[model samples]
Target: ILNFKNLEYFNMDFCTAFSNSFLQMSELMASLKYLSLSNSYLNGTILDQGLCELVYLQEVNIDRNNLSGSLPWCLANLTYLRLLDVSFNQLTENISSSPLMNLTYIEELWLSNNHFQISISLEPFFNHSKLKFFDGDIYAEIETSHSSLTPKFQLTSISLFGHGDSGIFPKFLYHQHDLEYVDLSHLNLTREFPNWLLEKNKKLKRLSLVNISLFGPFPLPIHCHKNLRVLDVSNNKLQGHIPIEIGEVLPNLVVLNVATNAFNGSIPSSFGNTWPWGCFYLEYLVLSNNSLQGQLFSKEFNLTKLKRLNLDGNHFIGDIPKTLSNCSALQGLYISDNNISGNIPTRLGNLSFLDAIMMPNNRLEGPIPSAFCQLRHLEILDLSRNNISGSLPSCSSPFNIRRVHLSKNMLQGPLLGDLSYNRLNSNIPDWMNRLPQLRYLILANNGLEGEMPLQLCWLNKLQLVDLSHNNLSGQIPHCLYNISFNYREDNHDLFDQDPQILYQLPQLQILYTNYHNHKYLTNFTTKQRLYTYEVQPLHSMSGLDLSCNKLIGEIPLQIGELSRIHTLNLSHNNLTGESPVTFSHMKQVESLDLSYNNLNGKIPPRLIELNALAVFSVAFNNLSGKTPDRVAQFGTFEEDSYEGNPFLCGQPLLKSCNENGP
Candidate 1:
């Protein structure tokens, strides 16, 4: 309160109610040395009459407020000021020429995200011998011509954060040998890789030069023993081979990302050969989108503490070294789009913490080892487009599997009847009915033969059921209408359940790669095109593909209760039915395909309500009717969508809606 005349520290941040009244008291706080009104939503100008008289104030933080108008030039009179943070405010107009330059003791200056006029020179502030941290847009070009005007301060950190024109790399950086953190990413600095910048900074920890115009090969330092933790130079024009001694030299590295570069040559064998088992501090190593070749070293990796390893988008050959199993903490392994051959090491199954293992588009062969059953936390297991054969491994339980991409291989065996693609060849497993999390059950293109098991209806959360291209028979289960996830209820007891229960589901992530510049992942066919879901939206994806099977019976009316289903394909099957009128309830349905089937009925008029329908095909069916009015998505359909039905007439077709031709 203003009553405290000697109060040296005043902080009103997030005090939404303390508005104009607080700004009025600024004139009384002449002795206040530190003041922070950040995010207080305070309005009004900080004019010459305000706290500008507090010339002895050491720090001021009024960031993220509604404050407007030019900060009074008299702020420069605060000769002892050490910190000034006015970022994210409406402070327009430039500060007086010497406002900040005159503060001989100002140490940290933050003027980012403000509307200040771009006519100020940063050169003046550099003269302060105590200034250490400066974050602001340098509008004027930093004059590198002044070799005599050396910076008086030793800056350990500098961040322009890609604001304003990126002037040439700060020349003064050469003199400040204590630099530890630097971020010049997404800037227009057209300089060659600055190898000399690391010469004196023995404690350099983090460095990011991403998306900059730095060119030429990265120079290998004479000695790389600094305690650097992160080095990201991704999306640059850098090239040449990574140094063979890099692993041994940068022993404290935690992240090494050089993706999307033109780097060539083999991954150095020294990476794993020199370090003793579990001696490295690295956790994430990404080298994707390069041309690195040669067999991954068999004895070079002792990565017991490693977590994420991405070597995809390369030409690496030979077996995935069995030594990879030595990384007991490995979670994500992406080796897709490579020439890696031979069996997946059974020892890899020992990594029970693995969450994703995507190795598609490779030359790997042999059956997936049963040892993988131990990876209870695995969510994505993709081995598609490989020479792999034999039935799928009988994982004792697929409790956490979300997406399994094993198509286009030499594999044989019955498709697992549930979301799991196990080696089960019997009636639909009873365990599948008990699974409350079952969503996608893709067993198409296999030797599965049996009745459509009624137990499947118990999967209240089922979304996608792809039993197509198989020998399935019997009637559709009517109980499918009772699916729990499809119905949103208002009676849910929010107070009775712990919110943490929702976190039990494994986190979804993309287990993918780009081959020939196209994303290659587990795909689902719908609307005449193959689709892949991104990780987040994948949670709401719903579809069914029971086409190309020998299924028999009437289409179940209960199917309409699945209001959340998006794509339903029952085409190319032996089903007879009056197009279920209940289908109109499938308001979210995007594609409906009932073609090449035995069905006779008037196309349900209510089906026209499916506004989200993007693809609809009912051709080759024994149906008779004036096709649903040419409206909404129906207007986009072509005659071929209804061609086989000689009795069906519509605008898309030349046939008229009459007794003889319609």
Candidate 2:
């Protein structure tokens, strides 16, 4: 809102609020020359009343907003106005016959993303000597029709986000040898990635052809750009191995992200060596979620400056590279959900500022190197579902840790030291309490113990806490009511008949309790008393799972308070509860797993309103009723996602229900 006395250029670009405040600039606007209000929330039709009052006005822009109405004659007076942009508005006007053609000095014209229908004859304004840049849906010839009429040397940039502008890929884009950047992202442009892109190979530095339906096993048959620095071809249906000679084609390709595609092939072995001796000094590598299967030959890339390397969700296996320590500047390493094995190298902790280590669901064993504490800046350490053994050390990480997933690991026993941050000098760092930054705590199936420390609740940043199947036995701390539990919940009595049972840590959105026994290989059959309880506002914990345990008594109707639940797993428990009408609150549940438990009741047909419910299972239960027609995925589920239920009836099961009435 700074006032200018001699403003040369005034552009209120994309500022909706400022556009509404322009009424106050009427006097100031009259004294000005160039004015631009591109993409503002300006309304009303163009009025020609005080038309040529501002004779000095040179350029005016009011593009992309709700402004609608006919062209005003006042626009013709500003003869000096060159760049006239009124694109993306609800403007209704003819292109050739409009008074805007009077601006003989007009340099650039833009009327794209608006409701302006292009008439066939739009070649009149094409002769404007200075009009080199124009954006509109009209495909009119934009050059003087002469034997050798040349376009001015002022054509460099263009933006086309969608249709109703420039009519699909411009058929006229052929022999313009000069270029720098071209962005055609998300336009439903149904054509092969224009072959001209690679062929046009002038001095273009950036090209984004993201999700333009450029289908193929390999879109580009040729890769011969020497200076292309950024190439993003993600989310397309492209398949096949990335041509190994890609480096030879584009020697300077630095950012190559072809993720989320359906490519099928082993990553080339001579990958890094093929790069023209650090030709594509790749700083970011993401080739995840494809059918790619191969040893992520990470040892190949010794690029000292590489920071992010993601090869996850593929079929990769093998020991993580020991030579990775050479990439000393690495900041993020993600190779999760792969078939990787072997112990992580001890030097991995040397990645001083490594923020995330996503290597879960792998066959890695051996205790996590205590030296991992050396990664003082690690925010996420996801080593879950690994065969890692031994107790965890009370982390003395200097930085605040956000996520820790040691779930399903063979790690056992109490933490190495006093485990309490209060005992910092004596081994445990008191900073742990001061560091209120534990977002996810999934230590399930680990042999961790020592009455759930009250100090843990100090992790005010807790979002997901899964301490299930552990030897933890203590009252659930009352202070953790604000922490969201994702996978499992700390049980009542913490598993003992202790009266000081920690009833609830209310912020839980996804609760998975070890319903019965603590020790592994033991069948839990507890005779706990059923008490009517009204859970507090536990609406945040959406997924509740109390399966794989033993607890005698019915489920509390208060369970209905979890309105946000998307997955409710109550199978394999000894609980006997009729389907309470209160279950209607679980509207968002996608997977309701109530099998293997001794629950008897008719299925709720109204439960079909849970439109998102994709997997419904009561197979091993004593329930009876005709399966609802909406039980689609449930019928498709293997007897496992729905096994154990005896009274349940569905197509996939042996028992068939007779009626839809519950």
Candidate 3:
């Protein structure tokens, strides 16, 4: 309760803990230059006498809290005050004239997020230059919103909403060449940005038209704005290739995020420029969800200062360039869903400080180089759906790994000796014994063999384990089924393409227990031999691959024991019999491709309950008896997904009613 008699600035809006207890500082307001008791439980009337007492107050902010009463009506007593923010309160005050009209020096006034029933009109404060940051949808700027025809202030950044301020988009927003940061994010604006944004690009630094109904390939001309930096047009209806000459567009740009857009073509090679000399000098770049093609990262450029680069869901091709090792400051690198080929560059292991590397769904090959084991600080490493081969490297130190995905590769060998679908070809991976903190582990689609190690069950930190689609044939481990981790959408297709029915995955997704790899089932029961497909991965690990091998047997009920398997691909096996009921425990599966198998039985509705089913496929199997109609995604079978299954019925195929009854 100190009397801040000489206080210059005081804002108590977000501090919903105290109250007019600050009124004890009246002795301080006498000489105060700025005072704001917003939402600080400030209640009752705002008397003219109480406010007029502060003759020297310069700024006031009282927003977002319960404050009642009308606005004070009096002659301009505090002529020195410049700002007044009284928003989000219960004030039925009319802001037309009174003392408000006299304060010509008042630069910024914010009156929103409140229950002011009175229709507000901004005719009081006009021609205020510093009054740029206006936040209200009550007919703010005349250009963006179709609300007000006339504006009161020369605002550079106005976020005015409609009705209760469902803030409308400013049509002429781009014309304001002086605007630096314009954020109308998530205000439910339905209008598209005007086309003139590119033409009038002036000194604007950050331009964000995200979540707006914008279309067309962004045609931003680089020479338009010399000072422009951040250009975020994410979550829009945009399409087409990122101009290959993007570096030529906004040369001084730093952050260029066009994520979730429909953009296509290769990442502009010109973007590889470095600092002090070449390229866009970018620090952060996210071009995910575009249809981009060709080597996403090349030896052409060296983004030494690049920290985060996300290019997921693009069609980019070729090997990750070794020159990219020059990005000494790189922290997060995501290049998944591309056609990139060749062995993962060992040079990347030199990035001792690198944290995340997500490059799934590519054509990358070669063994995971042991060099990556040096990244003691690594957090997330996902290399799913690639042509990668080779065993996991010996992890040298305590890895800070939280998520490790090596699924859907040609990798072969045992995974800590545990087998989800088939048996391992080598001994239990030695490096796995050292990982005490491993949370997620996926080793599907390999030629791995051997008995699962019991020590792996002791990993209290282990969450997900996917060792499907290999020569791994044996009893599933128990610790995985009972142990828990936050498994959501990864367990649905836990063991797809195999010749068996999937009965359960109590907590996770066993999406496609009968993964149908019919083409490779010629030698199903006899050939314990492993397929010779070559593979490698981004992480130097003791990988396991038995994919495309015609291994067959009864759908082991013990398969349910691998509780944490992530990617289980037992497709193409001539395995038979109903899926074991115990498999309902694998709560953390990510990819399960059990297609082209000899499995036969009704699709287990219990398996249909897997909430984390990402890639589920039980095509070309003998699965029968009206497939479960409970899950929507489950009913989404294509002609190919259930083609060879004569007994299967329901939507996604043609559902047949009981022939004997209605």
TM per prediction: 0.80, 0.61, 0.60
Best by lDDT: 1
- The best candidate by TM-score is 1
lDDT of 3 by residue, 239-335 (tens): 7777666676667777777887788766777787543333456777877776777766667777777777777767777778888898887887877
Cα lDDT of model 2 by residue, 1-662, tens digit: 24665566677677776556454555555667877776667877656223255567777777656778767777788787877777767788666777866776787777776666453223454456565565555434222333343333333444444442232454334534455555555555556557576676457665666665666655443646776766766667777887666656666765566766777777754346645734446666667677788676655656555676777678887888787787687777877778989888899888886877778668898878877888877766667667887766556544556555555666654432111111111112234565565433333333444454557657654433334343444333345434333324354433253111222322211111222111111111111111111111222333333344343467666555455555566555566768666666776666676667677877666665666666666656676655555354344555554456555566555666665532
Higher-ranked by lDDT: 1 or 3: 1
Candidate 1 residue spans exceeding 4 A from truth: 1-81, 84-104, 110-124, 136-148, 163-167, 273-279, 414-430, 433-441, 451-465, 479-520, 531-542, 561-565, 585-588, 658-662
Model 2: runs farther than 4 Å from truth?
Answer: 1-6, 11-28, 34-155, 163-169, 217-224, 268-278, 298-300, 413-435, 443-450, 461-662
Error of model 1, residue 353, in angstroms: 3.3
Cα error of candidate 1 at position 301, Å: 2.8
Clashing pairs for model 1 are: 272-300, 273-300
How does model 2 score by TM-score?
A: 0.61
Q: Which regions of candidate 3 fall more than 4 Å away from where they truly are?
A: 9-17, 24-28, 36-55, 61-80, 84-105, 108-129, 136-175, 186-201, 221-224, 273-279, 297-299, 414-437, 441-662
Which tens-of-lDDT digit does each residue in 1-662 have in candidate 1?
Answer: 66777888888788877666655566677678998887887777876236687766888988878778887777878887889998878777754353675776778877766765432234555577887776664444344455456778887666554544565776677777777776666565767777777666777777777767677787745676556877777767788887776776677777677777888898876567545322277777778888888987657577677787888888999998988988888888988889999998999999988988889889999988888888999877778778888776765668787567776787766544232233334455555665556556767666667787777787777666777777777877788676643432233332133222212323312212222322334456789676765423445667888888777789998887778788889999888978899899988888899999999878998777899999999999888878988887888889988888887876788877876655
Clashes of each: 2, 13, 114
**Number of clashing residue pairs, candidate 1:** 2
